[model samples]
Target: MAINYSKLFNRRATPQSQAIPGSGQVRNSAGGYSWEVTDWQRLDRFLILGAEGGTYYIGERDLVKQNHDAIIRCIKENGARVVDRIVEISDSGRAPKNDPAIFALALVTTHGDVAAKTKAFANLSKVCRIGTHLFHFAGYVNAMRGWGRGLRNAVGNWYNAQEPRELALQAIKYQQRDGWSHGDLLRLAHPKEVSREHAAIFRWMLSGQDELGERTVKRKVNCAERTATYAAVGELPALIQAFEQAKAAKGKGEILKLITESNLPREAVPTEWLNDAEVWDALLQKMPMTAMIRNLGKMTSVGLLKPMSAAAKLVVAKLSDQTALKRARVHPMAVLIAEKIYAQGRGDKGSLSWSPVQPIIDALDEAFYATFSNVEPCGKPVLLALDVSGSMGMAKIAGSCLSAREASAAMSLITAATEPDYVIVGFSAAANGHGGQWGGGEPGITPVNISPKMRLAEVVKEIEKIPMGGTDCALPMVWARRQKVNVSGFVTYTDSETWAGNIHPSQALRNYRDQFAADAKAVVVGMTSNDFTIADPKDRGMLDVVGFDTTAPAVIADFIRSD
Candidate 1:
């Protein structure tokens, strides 16, 4: 009698993830395993998604150490390449926030070989574009390495490289951050004054006095001459001076006028009067996009964003403006967070409270859609398979309170809101601690009642009820194939902890393609900085991307539209 090999090695017999050796597979941070991403890919992920909040499977310290080890390894191999990658991400506005890129650049400055350090110094100005950036870089550098001659020169050159006006703007907008004030950096760097304007600016930076008034040229010039001279390189300084005067202005009228006339930034405004609706209204007109988004709750708390108010009109107009969104680099992730927080009428942190403006919440949701090009929706039948496993619910996306499970559901709402034909499903296996658990409670590829028109909060509430277990990324493809569903594309929004599948996700996808849809594509959107993906690198039909990346929705849509 012939031996039945299939019975001996039943794929579903094991409760734990089966990672095959030499099959280009490795165990993930979660019990499930995935095909490991490359070092370069890992670097991009770390630079974009810092290890601030640890995931459910890993703590922040461990996550940071793991990612840092990857960076160190990359530097050991070729530090110059790492520096160039940092610059490219910083310059291209690929990431929503620049801090990660800046942080990584500083790491290279401290850890990279001589060639990498040289490249980092050469591009310091590019990475640290603002005073806050410089301050952040300094904070990171101070923790890692001492202020050596190379570090000091780069710091000094940063001060000298800016035009006088630009420098003054930096002074006004970002007075201090990350415990590194301008005074500290100036005293440490001791940059030589490149021009009289620079000299006066530097002097005033150290002392409280406005040194521009004591300049010889200003004294020699007549009133008109002085006005013209100041105007030539003084617009920014004038705003700064006006900001100082506004701080002293006792009356609300005077303060409001100064804010409108000088176009003062909110930073220039005193904290005492931020609660004043009228003052916040004046600040609203010229508020940068990011500032406006952040202050939404505050504005609502102050009653400025009430129904049919002028401030409300201005906000709606701003959110709708495509050019403003692009120029501000407003990612939907930021918008979504703001919207969720505002809708909740409170913050996850702090004692602040406000009554949410329904219209503004709706506008923010709409703006989230607007960040992606007004491209025609990818008119394809796509399947959104979300990973709602225990690990996903346990680990939060870095920089956010929402876990991977919550964020995946929220992200899926975007596709449901856009595409005409789609199905939403979640996949997980029931293996509590790997004890040969069978299919008793396996909710493999369950259909989630996530409707297209459901509010985001409502959808989140609904998915939280569904039980979370082990992850099986391949279940979507396998279930769909069995159901005879002809999916144009499959997008698995997960933390990439897909270890519970009987077969690998990549193989399952290939098998599905061979049967149902020959050109079917699968996209793995990694929700955390777990440096592994279920998608095979060699497969042209599969793409992996960072979750909450501002460019992701557009990229995913455009790629799927090809079908």
Candidate 2:
């Protein structure tokens, strides 16, 4: 018997404008509401499902155009994929109180050897774990394979976590007290406080265990300690020269050959030397004025450390003996120092302020709308793949505490309406100790964010429902490659955290690019303040990792504008 992906998955398809399986009426910016949607079709434009029936929401033709090449490559390589279409349903009646609903659909091709491909595809359908029926599939065939099932489960758990403000208050109560060692007081604090998974990493850092290896750490420690010592003695430049001389005398045993050869009495040798910690400390008292001046320059040069502003006052006080300077008019040295540190705050804390955060979020949200904005009322279907990994705990920075899935749905629905076909997929690995159970009962995918017809605001509320879990980028990427929808590139909101799965990030990325060859691009957003260290591409491959703004919608907007 031939394997029928669409039939087996319980997926339904429609090429013309239609209502999302369970959504309500869609509303326009002008506040006019309608139930009908239009389609926008372009050459080589494609959309795929991240899940079996989950649909994409691509409302803009320009976005489809930007990623058309990538979509085609995905189709030629992987088959039986999923995609979404955000069908706007509008009516003259007042907006409904309930959120809109989402529907999933899969796009399949009959041209290829369906039986062989289906069999090959079926082998890849390993459920995340036991009791979880959701299966993994090829990227091209079911582009959005992971979205529907994966997201549904994640959002449900998040919604149940109660209010975040309350959670944060609880987190503070359980957090380690100020002076206690991170280990002694907080290793096992609840997951909400220290994050069960991240505690080990935090502990590792506190233990002085630099994962980059001891040699590098030792070198840096030595350099920092030595520099601190020398500056206290007012001989920093001389110390640098001495070190350079030692290096020049490669393989020499001792560092201070010249000082020793003089046969000078130990006491005659100025106590200004920095060999002993006591001597360095004494020097601070003996030559406090000189040390302050010298250290200021070094502090300014090295960007990491912030010397107390009082140091500036010390400089003026010490130099006052040589020249009279008025505090109101400003000193030449002060001007020089100010210029050196000018704009230092530009890329530091100020840059990370709320102003910057808002624009990025606004742009991303706009990208979601712009994607389908250019498309006629009728546009091609799209696939929305959202990451619900453990790192997404910071998904909400403003507004109501909505689940991640809800945020994705709200933005996705708008885009899906741009096209007649689409799909959605949410993904994560089995939780810690859950063994093989990833998609049912405890920790399952549920589209609570979706209503029969969801509005953009309702989508935000739904996003508050996505729970945090493992960060595995491979599953979604692989699925997209196999389910070759005429995908408008896949959009994933994430903090770039990924575990070692069946496929490494490099390998997964390579396989996708090799098979699809520019057919689609993956957009990753940094949801938290955490840094995402993506490994350098092994085979000269390039992918996009965009830090998402305040909302997932803004992330979509950024993706479209970049194209």
Candidate 3:
């Protein structure tokens, strides 16, 4: 597939003045007019390109402020307090135009406006793609989308129990989840689109009977054939065999459909007797089941096949074999209480606790090791610089930074014995706020200097407790070199957002050598969406960076382990 360069470049390119919107100094790039404005212009005609050329109709905003206000209220009410502070005080008119954060919050809450939301998201993706900030937004979008899907699923189940038009929105949601075409599904459910053929099929399939007395069994068989847009006969052979299993056990009437259709009890059929061999024979007569079984056995013997254990077999038996094969089990660590320390604010504590995601921790361990394999563990001191800027406030990130701290500590604990003696230094260029002291006042990048130490948990706890501020990175780079400790390697975690600092990051590293006579090398792990673009021309070492993910402990651990 060719790269979509348009996606990278086709932003509105409408840069707002650096001065606050209502400020007198808010001058245009054109260098003439100074204006005080409350809100940004709401562009009409939100469009998305289809497979063909012309843009498809998406949505329009009546007044940008109305949408913004709706979003603020909805998010506050819904308890999605990710950007609540900024959103709560937003001037609906000014906020939408100035802040993508405000725009995203509002877009999600708007009712009966799927097209608008889609367009807004697409635009947001396009704008962020040019720089490193895209990843941060991407993570948030993914989590929000997942949460929405879950909410819709619950609503659907509820509506199914109580048949009401109030739940009618759920049918659309179900179709979306299934990846059905938007236009096709909408038309299908529309009252005018209900035709004689559709009505007959609906009545027959839904009512458990058809006019021809060719009830459940025959109907399903025919329905499967029609739906079988499957390119190959091998696909869904298990389902075909399931029908035969029902027929072989008793009769090929209503019994077969009940057995084959999803969500039915297993006691309804002879599933035990209908093993893979029997099922294969029943569906694809040409395939030799005995030979296949023998080949499977050979594979198992050679360790090429991961044979399903009896417990796994039982689990698979509950669902279609295909579903069982595709379904992933929760990682063993996900359910266990991790031997790690507690995390501070962000999201429902009920979900973030170690017990809910032990499997993720285990996966992180595996990933961390993989990433860590790249690092050469030496005797020198390892410097770990953390970003604790005001933006690093737990309020902004949805438990991401907290999770990262925990995971990093966990990895450090495991590697403490083998790796270099670790020293953690927390720095923020911002000033302290009402919440707590952070980094800066002028995007003020204040770098808090901490002597390097090996205690990872203690380091994490300290960073979490303190107010995280400005992201000036140059300070830490210079500070570490000044200490003249033979630093083997330095790993810095930051959001890559920067204010005007005296030295560029690369220059700071070079300055360390020239000014301080130090050989400490560094790799940066960017925790935010902002791209911390530090290129190493001298090939001193690689700059390892990654964006935040929900499962960062595992993801970053894997990234570090790979290093």
Candidate 4:
């Protein structure tokens, strides 16, 4: 794919001002911004990109020092108070555990002096749940190069093993089964600590003892070993062949055994394995409809039309069943999957056919509509404000193709649908007087109400129709207060990089509370990883949450109900 220089340049060029002192408005350059970094933003970058030693953007020694200092200051001041936020941000569900683990290792390797690094590592260790899963182990070992001593201590401490031998065995197993690089695994294995049997296996694999080579044999051996726990070594080959045949047949007995006994990695299983009729039938009998819906795209890709079509029929049949709909109503996963399905284009690879049968599309629409039923009706009236600013259109959600603007709209639609007495508005700065051009002159806030009853896709379309300009986050609350709507709560979905308005968002919320319902609360859902936050840290009525988290709606409801 060709690189889009213009888009890359524009993203870097976008200027963001800092509220902190000594960090003036920083224009985008080759490296280093002038603004003071916030803890959230610093940690966000750290988790996403790992440590930079004056190599990438903002990697200069002085700049890195400033970023590190800011983060340390935040930690020292907040202590355990910020621990939950750190864990939450680290587990943002954008990438697997590997990404964050690598970043954590990078922090230990690259940042701060000895004492500072130790403090940072201690803090990270408190939140980092390394070795909890296969990917976590793979990530830690992958990034363990040139840090053998640290790796040894980490495995001992983090894994809570008395001896390094247990850690070596686990590492070798992951390398053999999961296709992790052998060289990295060997470096961490510490030949002195490994048991003779495990060491032999590792050496055999690394030396290419068989024509099929180490990985192939290791996988078969691991599968067989896991399956025949009580069987002797001579029975391994037969056991491996039996396991393979069972997996290919997708027999229920073998499937259960593989999952329970062998603990086969889900990703390692071939798509064809999932395509089997017996497997689909078994899954439908055992798994919930929501889980099936989430995997629909994957099923479609492998041309499992019979199963995919059957699943679609099942979904449609359940749509009219109130009990079934009620069970799936509040879960956001269904809505998320439905939105992606609705947004998928013909050109998109591995997507459902360009013209999928009507029932499949209808099922998606119904699932999305059902999400509204899941929202517990907040008896009190509310106002939802969605930011449709140019900045909001700049980036897609971390792991998804949906842009921030689209996500904001989708979230707004859910809120509007759930609240019976609600007003939904999309806002951006108004055009300047000069031929209705954007920018300059006391720019005013523009807000437009979108119908709550509109379909989600339609709602997004209407939101897109709103003119995109400079962001003024306070405008929506300001508009609600000025209009005297008397809302009981306020919800704004934004990037939280508010700069256009003269008044801050917290101030606007305070003004709205004083003028209307003093007990009213506001929930600011941040859609991007910027440092700026509109919620007042000290205000009990204000709450800041990360967007795309399935639990956010429930959190908002609880906050609104709180005294």
Name the top TM-score candidate: 1
Q: Candidate 4, residues 1-563: lDDT per residue as tens digits?
A: 99986543442222223232232433322211222235755555444322333221233455456545555554555534334445454544322122443344344434334554444344444444433343344454344334345444543344332233433334333444354434333434333323444444344334422333434432211111111011111222222333344446544567755544443333323455665554554444434455555555554444443425675566557544556654533344345545466346232446345334455655566565554324566678877888887767765554344567877777676666666787777777643211121654223444445664555567667777777876667777777776777888888887665555545566667778777888988888877544446676667888877665555666777677667
Among all windows of ten consecutive residues in candidate 4, which has the lowest summed lDDT? 222-231
Query: Clashing pairs in model 4?
Result: 54-59, 330-374
Highest lDDT: give the candidate number. Answer: 1
Local accuracy of candidate 2 as per-residue lDDT tens digits, 238-348: 332333343345332332342344222222223234333332222222233323333333333332122333433334344443322221222222222222223222222
**Local accuracy of candidate 1 as per-residue lDDT tens digits, 1-563:** 99997655544332227764446677787666688888777887877666778777788889888888888888888999999988876775656578888888888988888889988998999889888999889888878887777887898799889988787777778876755566666666677667777665665565442232211221111112111011122123676678678778898898799889988888878788888999999999999998999999889988899888878888988998878887777866678788878889998889989988777887887887777544456889999999888888877765676677878887777777778899998877665332222455433766889885666788788888777777777778878888889898899998787776567777788788888888899989988786788777887899998776656777888888874
Q: Which ranges of candidate 2 are over 4 A from the true structure?
A: 1-381, 398-409, 417-421, 431-453, 456-468, 482-488, 516-518, 533-563
Better of 1 and 4 by TM-score: 1
TM-score of each: 0.87, 0.28, 0.37, 0.62
The true-versus-predicted C-alpha distance at residue 126 of model 1, in Å, is: 3.3
**Candidate 3 lDDT, tens digit per residue, 83-165?**
33223322221111123453353345333145444433333422322112222332334334432432223222222332222
Model 3: CA > 4 A from native = 1-380, 394-418, 430-460, 515-519, 531-544, 548-563
- How far residue 126's Cα lies from its native spot in candidate 3, in Å, is 24
- For each candidate, what is the lDDT? 0.77, 0.32, 0.33, 0.51
Ranking by TM-score: 1, 4, 3, 2
